[model samples]
Target chain A: MNHTIDDQVLAIGIPTDLLSTTVESLRAEILPLFDDTALKYSQVGKVHLNLCAVNMIDSAGVNFLVGIIRACQTRKLGITVTVKSRFVHRTLLFLRIDRHVELVVAS
Target chain B: MRVVETHTSPGNILGVDDDGVARLVLDQYLSRSGFRPELATSVMHAQQIIEMRPPGYFDCVITDYQMPEKSGLDLLIWLRSKDPCLASIVIAGAGEKDLVAAALRNGANNYLDKPYRREDLEQAVNKAVETTRHRRELARNEADAAAVGHLQRHLLGGRNLAIPGKVHFSHHPKRTAGGDFLNVHPCPDGALLVLAADVSGHDLKAAFVSAYFQGIVRGMLEKSTPIDEVLSFFNHCLWSDWGDRSAVTLEMPTSLSLCAAVLPPGRGQATLFSAGFPDAQVVLPSGEIRPCGVGGGHPMGWFAEALPERKTVDVPESGWLVLWTDGLEDHARQLAVSPWGLAYTLLRRDESTARRASIGDAIDDILVVAVALGSASFDEGFPILADQYAGDRWREIDAIQNEWRNTLTLAIPALSEERLCEILICLREGMLNALKHGCKGRPECTASLRFQYQSKARNLRAWIDDPGPGHGFDWASHAYVAQRDLLPSHRGLSMMHHFASRIENHRHGASLTLDFHLPEPP
Candidate 1:
């Protein structure tokens, strides 16, 4: 469950299993970035979540994405989610999350 | 010529020796010691003599340790196979301890050393004879019990009464006999009285009580006695009669856990009374299973006022009424499988490879009865996954969800990834709601999830229940507002509504069912 966060563009890497067990740690890791005004407002006009390595996602993971989307909306920033799993892509589409964020299903 | 007494001997002994003088001495000594002795020149001769008599005719066999061709150890081994109840004593020379040990290990009860005193001979023969007698008595008792068990199974097998609907019942006893019993009595008004009970033990006494209880029910019901009155009488019989330790010789009082159902001829109200038994399930025509309303009460004999808790269930025109003994539920929980799934597995002709392993290791006497009401057809909903979660152990949710994922993929291979995702999402959301809101994160509180697949309807349904007094909330209104306002808070319910083909809530929202229609199997 390795993840990486790019400070320059505010791009966060999601682990392979985006479940309740992993979401909490991911949330903790990203909480400080939200506190830094320079990272949230100045350096990044948009937040990119690279979920290309994700194999599965549960409701908690979906709720995590929703939290990120809500945060981006409050800060007047756009967000995009990139995933390689068709299941995850379909889940996002099915839940109608694509209406708010640009979802890219990487081949 | 010595006058040998034929009667009043303690035991009949078979004495074997290759030496002629030794055989004569053994015969004389045994006769003088108040025992009947038959002399055999060799091991083969001893076998021939013993084979002519009944199994327990000769109480003990005294054989010389060393013999031509076949030794006494060989005779001891053969005697074990021929008559395990018969005991053997080996006569060995001094310093032949190894041979004596081999004879003892091979079924010789005791060994007599060469040049032994009359007391030593008598002591060895007496102990061996007593051992043989005890073993023979035990064998006789076991044979009798087995015969009775055979009769019980035969009688119970033919006890499936004629009812309006198609009755499918299965009983698997843990041993030759067990406590689990079922009887169906057809009433005068075309109603069927079905009783499934599990007596306390798995022995002959339990089987006897089970038969007696069924007979009482049959007699009382035939006399036009009210169901409640009949139950009351039976409870009193247990509490004051069988279960009373003061008069009964039983070490512990007998308690009977049972569930009785009165299913009408057609679609009507069905009466269910459960006394410390698992809840019966009603499988609707749509394949939705609803457990009996009455949970359970104290088992009969537990208290003087241990009345059966009664509940009325609306029977569908064409559905299934399922009843089972608690053994099925206990085993299902021990295996972490769905009780419904286990029942269906035991009922169906074909078994899944995954489930067959669990069925082979059943630890209880299982009985399941499923009656189709008012029709010949009932949708078979195969349960694939079932689990319970403590409200405080939410951290294990991911691992458990993955297990469900594996089971669903294996059970319904045609289930597309998209539909599986929908199921897992709804399951997590529903469980989270149950744990966080319903259970209020109490460690003692718990929630359960059951997933059933209806192959005929191509539908997968999830049933989730939490032990909580659920609050009133219009989920539809919340979903509508959440979707319209793009709110993140209550969108999980909206997602559930969107993904599931239908949603049903029961027990004041404590129980939730979500159904997703699957594509045609490829």
Candidate 2:
């Protein structure tokens, strides 16, 4: 697992093999970042997150992502999640999460 | 050794070869097997044989691959295209892998190398015959499925026209058709039977029960069976066939809530029969509305012994009788008024020049007013505006006029003059009261009204409801004081009191139920 932060943006890179487990950990880890002073000053259009390296997401992982999106929305901050796998794109589309968040496909 | 004679079925095989010598060899093989086979010297000769005889002239076709003008694959394709079920075998002097594969793909049942064993020919014939039979069965099933598709479309399609003069009707199907059904049928006696019923459940099985109920009711009406007997027969049928077997618990109420009214053609009185449904209403000539009730009984199609109560109300000449499904009543109650009040307001507003203009331009004009008041987004003041204008001010007044004209034309046959006027007055007053007092400044406050008539008692009733609490002012005391003062503004309350036989508050101040009697018939 690799996590990097630049300005108010957070990027988490996980190997395809541990993608599901890494998403679960990152969802929990991302909450504390919102409380940080550097992130608090961010405007709606400034907050951006990348999960591009994740390949497989089950229902649980998808649910965690939805929770993060909702929390970000309540604070009036804009967040974008990058998904590289077609499976993830299809899963998000089916669940209608695509309607609420900007989905960036790396491929 | 003496050969056993075997009789071959007619047209069982066709043997084609180019050389006369090959034909001689086939003849010898046929005699040895104690059977007969047709022989053709060339492709043209085989064609000539087929043209002369009708189809099924031969059961199995055995042909050589190498022939002038046409190959074995060509003949196989032609025969199969003509009749897909036709079976054939191909034989060739030189065995080519590509040719064999192509021949089989083109529908050749079997292929043989030129130097073939005698037993191979017999085995090929047996397989071809079996393949032809299987293909025929598949064709039959396809035809059956097509027929079923046609029948389903005809039965479940929503093509029936809306019968004129009905109020507050909704068929929100849980499925294609549900346990609840309403049908208006014109009887041979020139009378109309309006039937509203609710079957047991909410699925396809429930739909079947509804269909069964419809058939029985229609039969009884056509036969002029007594209303009570119709209910009894339907109840007995459901109890015996469905009561215990239904997916719902045996104790679960498996009954239909029904209201049936028989209206004679022209301006004659109607006989009503009801079981477990909401009350019925008759709109009188003077615009007053009233409720008509039948003694209660279990809904039809419930228990075997459950008897339905029958009540007859003489629908006054030139008046209208309104019956409704539970959905309409629920929708009315949800709006905090009797469904009759909504009907009354609609009828009353329908007669106004401004509101009638709206009806001329669009049927949705009426629906829009009802929807706006019912909407939570509309503030209390909005309904007041609506009550004054009868609709949105943005809509063109001329267009509203056109819509009302059309609505009147459509509704004229079902409505009587006096009933129409009474409904309009009640609706105007009710709407004004809701707008001025109930919703005032709150945009979210709502109100609705329903008007109806009870012909037997010659009475009209209006039910008015608002989201706000009832008026703190005493209407009876107010009426008495207004009479004493002789104030022009106080005339509305006096008029309302004089026009109606009784006015009562219900559900606190949320609803006002008013009733008025109709004039006796000539």
Candidate 3:
């Protein structure tokens, strides 16, 4: 996971797999960027996750995503996930994750 | 056709006159006009003179009307039959209107009256010479094209040696020389390799490039270079070498759509590699057709990174592997028929149908090759696609799902993109469920996936089998929990139920089958 902060928005690139073996490492890498103390004055109002590389998401991956949605809710920051794979998009929709975050199906 | 202009050098003329004085006068007039005139005493003498030289060597034939033995009209008719393009002029009597009309009707270039002025004779000779020059150029072009076509047919469409499978191909060029080309190579490992390719344009230059490509392939394959590596080398040559040259010299860059297949002896898998070519079709013994590759490969010479898509396809005993270029698909689309159907029909050589007639007049060049894998006949179902996955490597689910999507998409091209995604989602969820629960993430446990298409029933079926017994949970209850309560744990089960048309549990839930109804072929 790679994240860049610019213009009050944090953009993150998701890895290819969000499965049981790899989800915890991604969560560890991604969750801290949300609550960094130095960002208090930077005003990061939105979070954008680029899931273009991801195609499959198992239960552990879904739970990790739900945790991120909750983190954005607590911080009062809008969250959007961009994806190119239809499977990832449909999985997020089926899990009701779209209710908390904006989901974009990129062409 | 080149327009021939004989202004600088007046053409050769054959002058026929019974009167020795008239012959001398005609010869002197022709010499003044910068023309070489060969004088003949009569029509028989003119025929002997004309036959001695090659046709059209004597550009114009000038004969006096009402001559003894063969008349001027008779000479004009004979010259017309011998060389239809040879120019002929008839000298008629001043009062003979019927004779002048008959000479013109028998293919005379012009008519001259007896005691005609020198100017009239020179003007007729000038016009006749121009006609002869133009027609001769056209005749030469036709002869060249026909000869090139004969060479292409024997070189590119020659019969192949007897190999493990039955291989037959049909190539129809719209013009005498076409851009499409194909070649069959017998591999040293008791296998057959076939190549079907189409150059960018339908012209002689395109044919030349095609022949050049075949020569390169033959030379490289003789050294036992892998087909994929050969294609990669070609792509590099096109992108770096020809690419730069064509950019500087040609109005538009040339490209090629290529498809190559390797079929081994006996009941072995056939590997197909495609670059900007339509997917090859696999026809089972029961007349069931399944597409063999993922397709959508970038054509060679288009990009430096245009690597051909390679896929392993099962060819059962007594089955067929049909390969073709997009020219057939383009023509088949216009005819509102399946390309595979047209290709199969062509391979079988069925001429009683309208498709065969349409193929004869295709707008583009078409090349098709069909190989029968074995000689035995069997009437059982065979998996068009089959794969095995270890549960411990569950992280490869994405790659496995991608293969499934490609195979299904190629097998049933009629499947809409949206529907295809949904079906793939279902298969992915099922495989994940099997890997997690049934195999328990054990390295020793493996799961198998297979897809079969039944064209007669318009059905596509996928079966997923796991080593362990399936989980005993009620799928309906889990689906209800996901739908009603929005729980994340059972959401995949819900998605599978929503996407797959029907799901059947077999072998105490160890094996699961999914069926999808296909649309009628157009």
Complex DockQ per candidate: 0.25, 0.01, 0.12
Q: Mind giving the per-residue lDDT tens digits that candidate 2 earns over A1-107?
A: 45556665655454442222345566566676656464565422344546565544443355456666666676766767677666556555644566677888886
Q: What is the lDDT of residue B89 in candidate 3?
A: 89
- DockQ score, prediction 1: 0.25
Local distance difference test, each candidate = 0.78, 0.55, 0.75
Report the C-alpha lDDT of model 2 over B64-95, residue by residue, as the tens digit.
Answer: 88888878777877777666776778887674
Off by over 4 Å in 3: A1-107, B1-9, B19-21, B54-56, B93-105, B112-120, B157-165, B244-250, B333-345, B348-360, B376-522
Regions of model 1 farther than 4 Å from truth = A1-107, B1-9, B93-105, B113-115, B161-165, B222-225, B239-252, B302-307, B349-364, B375-379, B382-391, B398-448, B455-522
lDDT of 3 by residue, B1-522 (tens): 556544566888999999999999999999988899999999899889888997568889898998888798888878778989988888878789998898888898788887878888899999999898888888887788777778888886453534323667777777788778887888889778888888888778777788788888989998999998888988887778776664456456678888888888665688888888877877676445667765666788887787888888888777767777777777765654445445544544544533443765678888887766676211223344555678876777766666666555544556766567667667777888788777888878888776666656667677888988776677777765554444446556666666677888887667888877666655
lDDT of 1 by residue, B54-149 (tens): 767898999998999999988988988999999988899999999888887888888888987888898888888888888877787687678767
Candidate 3 lDDT for residue B173: 75
Model 2 TM-score is 0.37
Encode model 3's per-residue lDDT on A1-107: one tens digit a residue. Answer: 88888999888898666766678799789867877574577789998988898866666677677777777777888999898877778777765677668899899
Better of 2 and 3 by TM-score: 3
Better of 1 and 3 by DockQ: 1
Flag clash pairs in model 1: none
